[model samples]
Target chain A: MSFIEKLKNAWVSNNSLLCIGLDPDTEKFPDLFKTMAKPEAVFAFNKAIIDATHDLVCAYKPQIAYFSAEAAETSLEQTIAYIKTQYPHIPVILDAKRGDIGSTAQKYAAEAFERYQADAVTVNPYLGLDSITPFTAYRERGTILLCRTSNSGAADLQDLSVDGIPLYQKVAITARDHWNSHNNCLLVVGATWPEQMAAIRQLVGDMPFLVPGVGAQGGDVNAMVKAGKTADGNGLIISSSRAVLYASNGDDFAQAARAVALSLRQQINVARA
Target chain B: MSFIEKLKNAWVSNNSLLCIGLDPDTEKFPDLFKTMAKPEAVFAFNKAIIDATHDLVCAYKPQIAYFSAEAAETSLEQTIAYIKTQYPHIPVILDAKRGDIGSTAQKYAAEAFERYQADAVTVNPYLGLDSITPFTAYRERGTILLCRTSNSGAADLQDLSVDGIPLYQKVAITARDHWNSHNNCLLVVGATWPEQMAAIRQLVGDMPFLVPGVGAQGGDVNAMVKAGKTADGNGLIISSSRAVLYASNGDDFAQAARAVALSLRQQINVARA
Candidate 1:
């Protein structure tokens, strides 16, 4: 199935817009799991989290650097495969902001899809079209472009005016008119900057956004929904990484994580209501 | 023992400014090497290139994508170790344009320095200070920041105006005034835009620039030397990847690569004269 179809399926069937970011730090892993092998521990923690809240989330977003940093690559692969087996319909977005020239980009696309089996991947727009075309060519896979990110420095270049328009607006327009021919394109607008997210949504027109920066980042879910939602009120994948994943560092971390996920999802629904 | 000191030592000792980019594509490898095992083949290919051109070059830049694309991860580690042991003084700038939030950036820094043992690693400054501070904290390692890239679509964002200044110019200024506190930071100024390269050189004074886009990208090498050089005429690492590495697809590809690197070096020196 196409990534968009799977995403929509997860959204409607699960009745959710929350994407749990699995950004693991070994330093923060619970004592019981930390005693296992590095890869084993990561997979265990991820499996426990997936088991608890797979039903409540539209998707799971894992940041690849966490695995690469720890050399838990095999565990990341296992984590993705486990999710596919346990919850077959829920998509996984690899939050790897990869950007390179054409050939190298092809390699990274392969790494994200073939090695880790991520349904969607995030890419940086720094190098422009040629850097992105390889990933966008994967008709079945989703290409989520980083537009206005959650961080303050996102304004460093992303908000700079290009011919009287900010660079992110141009990116949204480009994705809408040029790159979305396969309809495999999406945008990542930070929940921290809901106004920019709303403006970008207007420009891109109903293209699904994978919004990060809420909860731990102090972004209000209410503002995000009011500003970023399409007319249907369900066009955003609101992501909360640390607040959900590390809700409690004890043995009941999985249960605590589920509690956080459920609350965030409920909060998003409340805002929609 | 700092990146600049080692880079300067290589520059003077080698009497060359060329940094050969080791971006080996397996499909493009010679039939002879193709018969070897994947990891063995990659290591052999890299060793051959390094051995042949070590004397003619200032540094070796290995783009991590090539190894990751082929799953030749072990070979990449071995390749870096081999360079450090065989050519002890030449720096290896691992061209991984990594960017993420702070804690994640620390992991990437670990991946580049502790895992691979690269003398320097290229980082994308999109996420700003928090993403970069961990990298800059490694005072002995070179933190090469992407300023004005060589690709045509670089104008998409890097060329956009922030107030009255272009974003890239602002980046150059940021690197100059704020980020280079450790005196280990460098900027990536492409040979494709010698005019912008020149303007950046004036802004940055004598800070070393790790330049690409010299050969396969149709960038003028002579113009780059004339425009990008500091007053000392030794403040650049002009890199050429495919043009040198894949000069011949036959069995003599290694020798052919050496010939190209030598000619490129001589041409750069002539321009310097």
Candidate 2:
């Protein structure tokens, strides 16, 4: 099935918009991981989290740098495989924000889709269309572009007026019109900027958004749901990482994570109603 | 030594500004590599290219996508180690245009600097200051930001008017003024756009540029040298990948790669003169 179909299926079947970001830091691992190898610990933690919260989320996102930093690419592979094998319905978005020229972009596409078997990958728009064409070429995969990021410094360049439109809005409009021929394109509109997200939703229509910066980043969940959700309340893939993943540094971390995921999902639904 | 110091040392010692990009594609690998495993083939190819042309270049850029796509991170690690150990003065630029939120950016920084030990890494400037602070925090490393890319689609957003100045120029100005507190920032001004390169040179004032698109991509060597070179004629790292690495698919591959590297280096020097 195509990425969009799978995403819609996940949203309906799970009845949730929450996406759990599996950004593991070995330094924060529980005592269970201290005795095990780095890769083993990461996979174990991810497996436990997935087991605990698989029914609560619409998707799973694994930030690539966390795995690559620890030289735990194998663990990342295991984590994705475990998710695919076990859940089968929850799409995986590899949050890689990769961008380069065409030839190099092809290799990155291969890395995300072929090497890791992710259903979607986030890409940077700074290099423009050709850098993105390679990822969007995978008609079955989703290409998520960074629009307005959650960081405070996101305003530095994203807010620069481009012929009166903010650069991020231009990015949203460009991706929606010119870059979405395959209908596999999406924008990453930060939940931290609710007004911008609302404006982008109006500009991009029903194109789904992978919304980050809600839970641990202190973004207002109510504002994000009101601003970012589609008419059917299905467009936002609200992501929360550190808050959900490291809720507790104990053996009951997975249960704690589940509690956090359930609460966030309920919060999003409340705002939706 | 700092990345800039090492880069300058290499330019003086080798009398070349050329940076050979190690972007291996298995389908294009020579017959000898067909017998070896993918990682082994990649590392062997890189080692041969580095051995054959190390004296003729200022830096070795291993595009991370090539390695990650093939699950050959080990090969990339080996290649960088080989250069750092044998050709200590020659910097290695990992052409990974990575950008993310501050927390995730810290992990990406570790992946590039600690895991791979690259002297520098390419980054996308779209995320603004906080996304870049983690990278620039490493005072000795070079953080090369994309300005005007070599691809045709580069003009998609880069040429947009931002307060009357083009967006790429704003990026150049911002990097020069705000992001270079450590003096470790550089711009990637493509050789395909020489006039823009010259304009950025005027804006950024002697800050180095990692120039791609010269050989196979049809960028003008002479135009780039005249446009991008610093006051000391030492600012550009002219990188050519396919034209050098895939010069032959036969037994004399390394020698052919060296010949291409030598010719490109000479071409750059002639332009400098």
Candidate 3:
């Protein structure tokens, strides 16, 4: 199935928009996993979190840096496989944010899909069409482009006025008009900026948005749901990484993560209603 | 020492501007290392190429996607260590093109510097200063920004006129004024578009340009040398990946790569003089 269909189906079936980010920092791991190697410990913690909270999220976004920096490809590979086999319905979005020339980009696509088998991947749009065309060629996969990012420096270039509108809006227009031939293209509009999210949602009506910044980033959950949702009230994937994954550093960590995920999902549904 | 200093000192000592890219693809590997595992074979191939051509280049840029995609972190780690231990002076630019939030960006910097030990790393400026600040904070390292990339789709968002100035030029202005506090900043301008290369060169005066698109991408080498050269006549890192790495499909691949590197460097010197 195409990524959008998988996303929408999973969204309705789970009744949740929460996307817990599985970004593990070795330095921050609890004392229990120090017995094993760093990468293995990271994967073990992720597995525990997934087993506890898989039912509460439409997707899981794993920032590749956490694994790549440590040469933890085994853990990354195992994590994606485990998700696919165990939670079959939930999509795994590999947040690599890759952008390169055409030939090199083809290799990146192969890496994300063929090696890791992620259902979706996040990419940077700075290099333009050809850089993204390779990723979009994977018709069954979702290519989420960065629009208004959930960072303080996003204002650096994304807000620059191009023509009468801002660059992020231009990115939205381009995605809407030119890209998305296979109906698998999506966008990342940060939850930190609800007013801007409303403008973006209005621009790309009914399209799904992978919204970060709802939990640890301190973005208001209600404001995000109100402004970021599509017409059918089900077009948002709210992601929370640090706030959920590191909710509790002790043995109750998994339970604490589940509680946070459940709370975020329930609040999102209430706002949707 | 700072990356720029290393890059300049190496360029002057070698009297060359060529930067060989060590982006290995297993399927494209010569028949010799095919017996080993993919990662090992890729590393062997890179080691051979580096051994043959280490003296004729200013920098060695290994696009991290190829290695990361293959889970060949061993090869990547070994390659960087080999260059530092063997060549010592010539810097390695880990062309990851990474861009993200502040916290995540910090992890990526660790991956590039701490894990891979790359003296310089490429970054995407799309997320603006905040995403780049962490990487630049490694004042001892080089933080090369993507201004006008060596890709066709670079025109997608980069060429859009932002208040009479194209987005790429605006990027040039920002990199010049805001981003380069430690004198370790550089820009990647495609060798394909000599006119744009010239335009970008004028804006960022004397700042080195990591020029890709010279060989297999069909960009003119002489034109790139003339337009991309800094005022000191030695600031262009002319990169050619596929052209040099896959120069031959036989055991003579290393010799052929050395030949290509030598020719490119001589051609660049002629253009500079």
Candidate 4:
């Protein structure tokens, strides 16, 4: 099934738009995990969180840096495999943000889809169409492009005006008009910028957005949903990483994570109405 | 020692600006490597290339995609360890091109410097300074920022005019004035666009450029050197991967690679003079 279909199915089945970001920082782990190796601790924590909150999330987003930082790619592989096998309806988005020249990009595409088996992958659009095409060529998988990022410095380049339009809008237009030939393209319009998200929504027309920055980053959940939601109120995959993952640093961590995920999902559904 | 000092030392010791990119594609491996596992094959090939041409180049760059795609991170780790161990003077630049929000960027920084032990790492500038600060925080390690990439579609966003100056020039200006406080910052100015390279050189005076696209991507050596060379003729690290790597798909592959590296180094020197 195509990534969009998987997303839609997941959204309907789970009645949630919350994408739990599995960014395991071992330093932030609970006391019980202090003795285990970093990778094992990450995997154990993620499994518990998944088992507790699978039905409350539409997708699972795993940031590659956390695993790779500790040389924990094996745990990452196992994490995705477990998600795919146990929560088969939920799509897995690999937040890699990879961008390179054509030949190198093809290898990254293979890395994201073939090696990691992610249903969708986030990529940087700095290298333009040829770099994006390699990922989009996997017509069934989703290729999420960065438009207006959530960071304070995103304005350093993204907000630069080209002619009369801003650069991020240009990125949005290009991704919408040119790069989405396979209908597998999406944009990362950070919830931190609600107004920009609205503008991007207008430019892309129902192309689902992977909206990050809503939790620990302090992006307003209601404002983002109101600004970025499509007619069906299901166009945004609002992601929360640290806020939910580290809700409690004790043995109740999984329960705390599930509680946060449930509250976010409910808040989102309320905003949808 | 700082990465810039390491780079300069290697440049003087080797009397060359050429950097060999160890992007090991198993499909392109010579017949002798076909029977081995992908990771082993990649490590063996990279070891041969490093052994053959270590004396002929300023630095060695191992593109992470080639290893990560095949779940060969072990080989990549081993390759960098081997370079640092056997050839202590030569700097290893990890061409990762990573960029993200501040929190996640920290993890990526750790991945590159701590896990892989890369002397320097390439990063994307689209996310701005805060995203870059985590990498630059390692005041001793080099943080190479992407300015004008060598890809055909680089102009898509890079050429956009911001207040009459191009975006790439703005990037060059930012990297020079703001990001170089520790003197560990470098710019990636592609050899393909010599005019742009010259312009960037004018913007960021004498800041060393990690120049890619010389051999395999059809960038002219003399044109790039003329455009990008500093007053000392030593501000560029010109990289070539495929041309020197797969120079001959036979048992004499290592010999062929060394020959190509020698020739390219000679050409760059002639251009420098």
Candidate 5:
């Protein structure tokens, strides 16, 4: 099945649209795991989180940097393998906002989709269409391009006006026009920007969106659902990281995470209906 | 010493400002290596090329995609390790062209700099200061921001004017202002556009540049040097991939590659003088 179809099926089967982000902040982990080992501790923590929340989430978005920071290629490989083996239905969106020239982007596409085995991957579209074309070449996989981001500094470029239209709007339209040629394109609109989300949805029609910035980043889930959801209510992949995964520091961390995921999922379902 | 100092020293020591790109295109390899094995043949070819051209060039940029297209993290790790062990003095720039929001970008910074042990990395500045900040945080490492590129379609967005200044110039100015705080930022200006290179240099001052498009991309090295050279004649690192590494298809490919590197280096030196 296509990545989008698989993702929708996963959302329906799991009864959740919550994408648990595996940031794996070293300082947040308990002191016990800190001293255990380098990449082992990271993998163990990730595996436990995945096992606990597998049934509650439609997808798992592993922020590549956390594993990369440790220079732990082994842990990264093992994490992907574990996800593919344990939760075959769950989509994995490798949150790597990579964008480069054509020839170079081909390698990044291979690294994220082929090596990591991610069902979907995040990309930066600043270099224009050619930079993003390589990722969409994997027609079966999903390519999530950054549009209106949730950060405070997003206005620096994304909010700039280009010929009376905001740059984000242009990016959304251009991505829809150019990237759709490959038939696997999605936009990343931060949950924090509900108004922009509504506007972008109006412009791009039914393209799937990877809506980040919900949990610890203080984005309102209700507003995001209301503004960002497609006409069919299947286009939004609401992602939360710290609020769900690191909900509690105690031994019941996994259970606490599941509880948060369930609540978010239920909330999304109600909003959709 | 800082990365910039190290780069300057390498340029002087090698007597060649040329930065040979080790992009091992599988199709360009000799017929003998094609029958040998999968990644092993690629690795063998890369090792041979690096051994021959190590002294002829100041830096080696391995376009991560060539090895990454194999979809194997082991190959990526092995390739980086080989460069570090075999050519220790020649700085290795992993041309990943990664950029994202501040929080996410911190992880990429750790990945490219800490994981791959790359001396320098290429980044996209479309996300503004947040995207580029994380890389500059590594005060010791060099961060090359994308300016005007050598590609045909780069003009789509990069040529668009933002309040009288072209997008690439604005990127350069912003990178110069924000990246100066860390003091380890450079620009990626294609050798194909010498006029843009001259204009960008005026905006960013004496910062070093990684100039691509010199080989098969039809960029004139002499024009690039004349336009891109700093007052001290140490600002440009002219890079050529296909022309140098694939100069021959026979067993003597390494020697043939070395001769090309030497020629490019000589041209750069004479042009600068």
Candidate 6:
């Protein structure tokens, strides 16, 4: 199925647009798992989180760095396997933000799609068409290009005006005009900037946005949904990382996460309506 | 030793400012190695090339995409190991251009520095200060920020203006003022645009530059040195990939690569003088 259709199906079936970000900061993980002496503890913790919130979210974004940083390749492979087998329907967006020259990008595309088997992946578009083409080449997967980010320093370069348009606007247009020819492109607009989100929504039309910065980052979900949602009310995938994943660092962590995910989903639905 | 001091020593010791780019295109490998297997062949070729050119250039820049695209983690690891072990004095710049959030970036920093053991790595500063801080946090390694790239589409954003300052100039100044507080930052200016290089040089003062766009990309090295070199003539690490590594596709490929590296180094020395 196409990425959009799959996303819509997942959203409707799960009755949620919230994407649980599995950043898995080792320092933030429960002490029990930290002292487990093996990487399996990390995967076991992730499994519990997925089990608790799988029904409450449309997608799961596993930030690749967390896994790769631990030098836990096996854990990464197993976690991906579990997500694909156990969740089945929930799309996985590997938050890799990878970009390189054409030939190199092909390898990354293969790694994310073929090896990890993610439904979508985040990409950096600074290298231009060649860097983005390899990811978009995979017709079945979604490619989320970084546009206006939520970080305090985003204005350092993204706010500059190219020709007559801000750099982010130009990125949106290029993503819309050139890269999305395959209809698999998405824009990553931080929920922190609703005005930019609204403007980019106008430039990008009906394309889906993987919007981060909603919860712990203090982005207003209602404002973001108002600015980011498609006319059909299916364009936004609002993600919350620490606020949802670590709602409680104690034993009720999984339940706390589920509550957070459920509340965000309901909030998104209300805002969409 | 500080990254800048190491670079200075390499420059004087090698008597060459040229940085040999290790962008090993699988298709461009000599026919002899093609039959050896996928990544093994790639590594074998890289080892041979590095062995031949180690003394000819001051630094070796491995464009991460080429090795990464092949799903060849072993080869990538081996290639980096080979460079670090064989040429301890020469710096290795992993051209990954990675940038992300704070937590994620910490992992990337570990991957590039702790795992690959590169002397420096290229970064995309689109996400702002938090994205770049993790890399610069490692005070011992150099973090080269993408100021102006060598691609045709660079103008899509890099040339944009903000508050009367060109985007690239703003990025250069930002890197100099904000990110350089650790004193471990560098800028990436494409050798393709000499005028921009000159303008950025004036903006950034004396920080070292990892220039790529010589050779196959058609960047003018002489013009680039004229515009990009520091007043003391110690701030450029001009890189040529396709023109050097793929100089010939025969058994003597390594020798051909060494010859090109020598010539480029000679050219850079003469231009600076």
- On DockQ, the leading prediction is 2
The list of candidate 1 runs beyond 4 A from truth reads: none
Error of 5 at A193 (Å): 1.7
Spell out the clash pairs found in candidate 5: A107-B65
**Tens-digit lDDT track of model 6 for B20-69:** 88877788888998778888988898899889988878788887766655
Tell me, by lDDT, which candidate is best.
Answer: 4
Using all chains and alpha carbons, the TM-scores for the candidates as numbered come to: 0.97, 0.99, 0.98, 0.99, 0.92, 0.92
lDDT of 4 at B84: 91
Error of 4 at A32 (Å): 2.1
> Roughly what TM-score does model 4 have, to 2 decimal places?
0.99
Candidate 2 chain A weakest ten by summed lDDT: A24-33
DockQ-wise, the better of 1 and 6 is 1
Question: Residue by residue across B138-244, what tens digits does model 3's lDDT show?
Answer: 99999999988877788899999997999999999999999888778899888888999889888888898888888898888788788788778888888989999
- CAPRI band for model 6: medium
Candidate 3 chain A: worst-modelled 10 consecutive residues by lDDT: A25-34
| lDDT (tens digit, per residue) of candidate 1 on B184-237 | 899998889889999999999998999988899888988989998888888999
Tens-digit per-residue lDDT, A26-106, candidate 4 = 999999999998889889989998999999999999999999998999999999999999988899999999999999999
Superposed by TM-score, candidate 2 places the C-alpha of residue B241 at a distance from the truth, in angstroms, of 0.5
Q: What DockQ do the predictions score, one after another?
A: 0.61, 0.90, 0.85, 0.87, 0.54, 0.50
The deviation in Å at residue B245 for candidate 3 is: 1.4
Tens-digit lDDT track for model 4 on B1-273? 989999999999999999999899999989999999888999999999999999999999999999999999999999999999999999999999999999899999999999999999999988998999999999999999999999988888888888899889999998888878888999998999899999998888888999999898999999999999999989999999999999999999999999999999999999999
**TM-score of each model's B chain?**
0.98, 0.99, 0.98, 0.99, 0.96, 0.98
lDDT of 3 by residue, A1-273 (tens): 878888888898898888999998877776787789987898998999999998899999999988877778899999999999999899999999999988888889988999999999999999988898999999999999999998988998999999899999999989988777777789999988899999998898887898988788999999889998877889998999999988888888899989999999999999999
lDDT of each: 0.88, 0.93, 0.90, 0.93, 0.83, 0.85
| Collision pairs in model 6 | A107-B69
